[model samples]
Target chain A: MEQVYKRTKGIRDDMVSGFCPGCMHGTVFKLIGEVLEELDILEKTVTVQGVGCCGLAMEYVTYDCTTSPHGRACAVATGVKRTNPDRLVYTYQGDGDLASIGLAETMSAANRGENFTVIFVNNGIYGMTGGQMAPTTLIGMKATTAPAGRDPKVHGYPMHMCEILNQLTAPCYLERTSCNTPANVRKTKKAIKKAFQNQLDGKGFSMVEIVTSCPTNWGLDPMASLDFLEEKMLKEFPLGVIRDKSREEEAV
Target chain B: MARKFMKGCEAIAEAAVRSGCRFFAGYPITPQNEIPEYFARRLPEVGGVFVQGESEVASINMVYGAAQTGTRAMTSSSSCGISLKSEGISFCASARIPMVYCNVQRGGPGIGAIQPAQQDYFQATRASGNGGFRMLVFAPATVQEAVDMTYEAFDYAQRDRNPVLILADGVLGTIMEPVELPPMRPEEEVKALKEALSDWTLTGHRAEEKALILPGGWAGQEDRCRRNANMYETWGKDVQVEEYETEDAEVILTAYGICGRIARSAVRLLRKEGMKAGLIRPKTVSPYPYESFDRLNYGKVKAILSVEMSIPAQMVQDVELAVKDRCRIRTCLRSGGEIMSREDVLKAARELV
Candidate 1:
């Protein structure tokens, strides 16, 4: 063997990740890094991360990184992209950061068709804040805020972000994928890469919602959490492409 | 390069472009709506970007993002809109990103009025945002001053890697005057300016390199805050004040923005009556021209009249601090969107002299 296989150069070797053990954020970060390295955009990319466990991507990502207030990552990334139209800009936000407090910014940016990418990590709970109820928490899911279980009458149903964004004419790409099984992990990586490529092509707004797991927040083992993501979360938020206007742009 | 009649808001928009500002993101509001409207039609002509953001909150953060790339970016809003931008301004301050913004102020405490008023003096000079951070506030008295101060505000922002504010009022924002516009910056010069700040900007760097922009969320922030305090101290030398006819005066008048311009007219009228009167106007309100008071001939000066277009007067506190109670201090006040007249200032100066 020529020993050609190695770690992606898009990630920092000396940096210590701040994510908890068995957190799916590490896997998502690696997928992003591998994609950036393969696409040769690691040097020109700027990452704006929200305030959460996913926001810790600033420490591990090799690109220039910025931190936004809890839910303003999309707004901040919009600033970065509009100001420096030449550079590649993206934001990594958690479920609570993207779909809850930041819902206004998320929708507005998508409507404007901002030329950037958003990597939304949907882990069903707020991992950083001790598993608080997220907008994406299942109808029966339990959280610190929802002590017993989520009730649709009071708590409201989980937000389907990709489906909501798909209806917008501005966004050129919108996809939902999971990181549970090896096959699904491969698909998630591909979706992330496609989103980045859409921005590079100047096709306007793109987003990749990765259905992830939080072992500690969910109070389950790492393997059990992956099973839960596949069995329950996948049923509600089906994994597939919801919108792909990029294909139309290609034909033009 | 051209001398043309223009509204204060329109003149500021042109000056920002001439100063190499390539990014403008703003939302529309009364008194300041001309700023964004002007930029929308003008920035693209100069190879710049202009975005009418969804709201004041979004517009300011967009400026924050653009500024990190080492470009001159800015936004403009009125009193209430500025309240929404406070959070974004705090983030820019903590991150040490250089950007400029303008507040064409209106009467306020909460949607008080849309007309001209200087009620925001306390808000602009004192507590702009959540942090202990202070912005170098420029209070322009005329459309000419508005053009000049706005052109230089960008440099002040880049010098300290912080935010600078041009605090005008609705009177200055909507009124028209003739201004000699500065020369438009060449495209190459704009690129050079951005390149000059590359060492600290968030532009893509190699894997081994690090860009330290945290935006108010960071570890070991105590040390970073102390560094900011040291920078604030140096602003004493950067203070700008215009002194007119202060030599051998019996009474001095202190004001800022349009109030300063109105008081200047009052000074001329008082001097004609053979009453010794002078004017001390601050161009930068944050690093206030406290030294101008020290230069006054205390032996000849009897009283200092603080004139402003606000209720119960807010700038009196600063004037008192500068005077140190060396002489009598009186405030000529107006509010509820009322413009302070030259006659009122003359009346106040007559009582003191």
Candidate 2:
């Protein structure tokens, strides 16, 4: 059997093993690397990593990488894309980075039709800064910020970014997926690849929101975390293509 | 390449495109919105990028990020918008990022009025942002100058690896005049710039080399501070100014931006009347043509009249400081979006004489 381990380009060698076991950032990072390599875009791509657990994503991606202030990755990526239209640009943001502090930036960038891909990870909590409840954290679910299972009466319901982005006519593609199982991971990878390809085709904004699991934050073992993602998280954040402007058969 | 009648703001936008700017991010503000509109239509045609940002703050940061990738990028806004961009401007200055900013002057401390005013002179020339960092400020009086200086701003920014400001007034932005556009630099030249500045730009690592990490934090940060100061010193050496009819004149009129044009008209009237008044316009506000005052023959010049369109006058202080006891000084100003008329400047100069 062939060995499966490999390091992504542009990642800092020392910080490669920092992700918590079964955190899913590492898996998503690997998936992104594979997509970039397969699409022949690794050399021409620049990734703007947002602050959060994903901010440390610079450690796992070998392409050109820069980190933005918390929740400012969309704005930064807009700059990078506008500056060098020939270069493929993308931003990896977490739930907290996208739905909370960066909501304005994310929505405005979408409205402006900036031609860049955004990979948003909806892990239901702010994993890096401790298990704080994120904007996408499901109502009735417990986390540091919401100790008593998130009460909708006090804290709003989970934000569905895919549905929100789908409402914007500027976005050429928008999808939601999960990475709890092998088949779901394959679907998530396809969604990410399509997002990149849309940019290469000069299509406007594209995004993939991956419903990932934070086992350490959820207080669940790796397998239980996967089960929680599929059983609980998927119900709140349904998995499907919310918008696909690129598909010829799809109706406006 | 061709001559066209264009507003100063429109001409500035055209010049930016001709100078090989591939990215433009700005929010719509009165007087300068023509610039972003021009880019909205032109940039996409060139396969470039144009974004109308959420705010001036976001727009400037977008320029900052784009410039870090070694591309020609710019943003334009009015006085209030510029105030919001101060933080990003300082960051760009500290990072030595090459970007162009266009400030079409307007009145007031807060959304004073959309009409042309020179009240931002102090903000543009001094402490526009936090830190002791200085920007190369170009004060364009004519629509033609507005367009030409915009191209020059980009060149100066790339050459100095710092932010450059094209400081024109609302009159310059809104008023129209004929301008002969210059030929654009080739794309290859801009790409070559990437190679030339690769040492500093935050591009990817070269083969077999450790990735260049820009030093962060307080450790040895003083050295970076010193480097920024050194850059300002070097730029000061190349200050630009325009002088007219100083020979055998008893009074000198010091002005910039639209006021400079008014001063010129006033000087013509004063010269026709044989009152012996001349004009000195500081084209670059930051380096401020300090030497021009040195060149003035104090023996012939009796006093100096500083003219501008602002209250609690700003540029006058610089003029007084520059001349400092060499000659008596008085200021003629119009606050509340009022322009200093030619007659007003003439009356002030006559009184000083």
Candidate 3:
């Protein structure tokens, strides 16, 4: 019998990813690796890794990667791209890294129209730090910090990044997709590809927010975590392209 | 190059460009705003990148990123603004990223005042950030020295793979003085310099090779700390200080930055009066010219006086440690943005004697 499928060249075959079993980071990393392979830009691409569960994406991804202190990946990515304009640079950031401590950097980079890509993985809880309440942690969700279900009165409501970033005029693309189901996972991959393509075309700032899940941190099995992300997380963060300016000339 | 009367901030900006600094990121802060302003117009002309970051915190990280790419990068801010950048500076040091920054210091233990003061001497020399990491610090007294120090800082930073800071006061930042600018670094030279760092820069590498450059490099916490300690030990060899008229003197004066210049004037006045007064100024305050005191004629010197722009005196502690109580030490301090006057330094010297 012949093999039907082999690992993508964009990812290193010999290395084991540090992400936990059933964690969606592997799915997202695989998708990114496939995208890099499809685009054939892995040789010139660099990944700015954020500090969190997403930081370990470097272990699996073959492209050059540099780590930034917590929440500064976008800012670092801006520098990397600005200095090496010919290189394709992107930041792989988790919910806490992109939303809470790094909110200013994300908003400012997008507002300035920095020429880079931001792959924001919104998993609702701080997975690496053992499930602390993230800026995107849903209301009534239980976290290590919020022992008794999160209350909007104290914890505040969850932040919607795509909708917020879509309000900015400079972004060439802004989309919110998920990896919960086969269909949604395909859509998320397409969204990531479009973001990367926007950078290659010199279109300006592009961001793809992918709704992912943390099975271990969510206190659920892999299947239940996917279901939770589909039913609950999707309610807070909607899926689909929120902004696309690449077609503005055709639309006009 | 022909000498031009330039403002301290503007000269430092041009010197940074001449030093091959192609990436400049900064936020507007008092006494240092002109630096970013100059780079905003100049950097684009030289095919460089200049970003006016939303905050000091963002600006330093931007430099941190650019430095990781092996580009000569820099940022500037005043006293409290540097405090805002402490975390990123700490990260840069921990990661062994090379970059330069300037502190056009102003009065502050808090948001005290915007006028000139050397109150940040302790902050810049002793504890720039949380980690016990030390940077090569240069305290310049004039626009010419500031320009020279700022230009040389890039080389030192790249040589040591560490952050180098220019500690200048608001007076030095805002004042105009004649300065002979350094030659502009050629574009090809800049590219070649960056290319030389390809082995360590954060560029994409082959899949089989390990390309990760972690903070303090592939070592555990304690081991990294030990490596950092060893690096500092090597850097200790670069300790630099300037001694003026100390030979055959009975009383010696010590200061840094603008205070040192004032003490130099006081020493001149004391020397004309036939009194034996000399001056010792530390150029690199961290490696700090302790040996300058060690080489002093302790048999002739009666006492040491420190002049500074801070109340309760900060640099005096370092001076005391250097002198080791071989001679009496006294301090003349002017706080809350008060400039240390030469007359006050002269009077302090007289009292010490």
The most accurate candidate by DockQ is 1
In angstroms, give how far residue A233 of model 1 lies from its true place.
2.1
Which CAPRI quality tier does the interface of model 2 achieve?
Answer: acceptable
Candidate ranking under TM-score, highest first, comes to 3, 1, 2
TM-scores, one per candidate: 0.96, 0.83, 0.97
Per-residue lDDT of model 2, residues B2-43, tens digit only: 679987888898899888788899998987889999899998
The residue pairs found clashing in candidate 1 are: none
- Candidate 1 lDDT at B10 equals 96
Model 3 steric clash pairs: none
CAPRI-style grade of the A/B interface in model 1 = medium
- Quick one: ranking by DockQ, best first? 1, 3, 2
Return whichever of 1 and 2 wins on lDDT.
Answer: 1
A122-188, model 1: which lDDT tens digit per residue? 9999988899999999998999999988999999999999999887889999999998888988999
Top lDDT hit:
1
Clashing pairs in 2: A9-A62, A10-A62
Please, what is the whole-model Cα lDDT of each candidate in the order they appear? 0.90, 0.84, 0.89
* Alpha-carbon RMSD of each model: 1.8, 4.3, 1.5
Candidate 3 segments whose C-alpha is farther than 4 A from its true place: A1-4, A250-252, B216-219
Worst 10 residues of 1 chain A by lDDT: A3-12
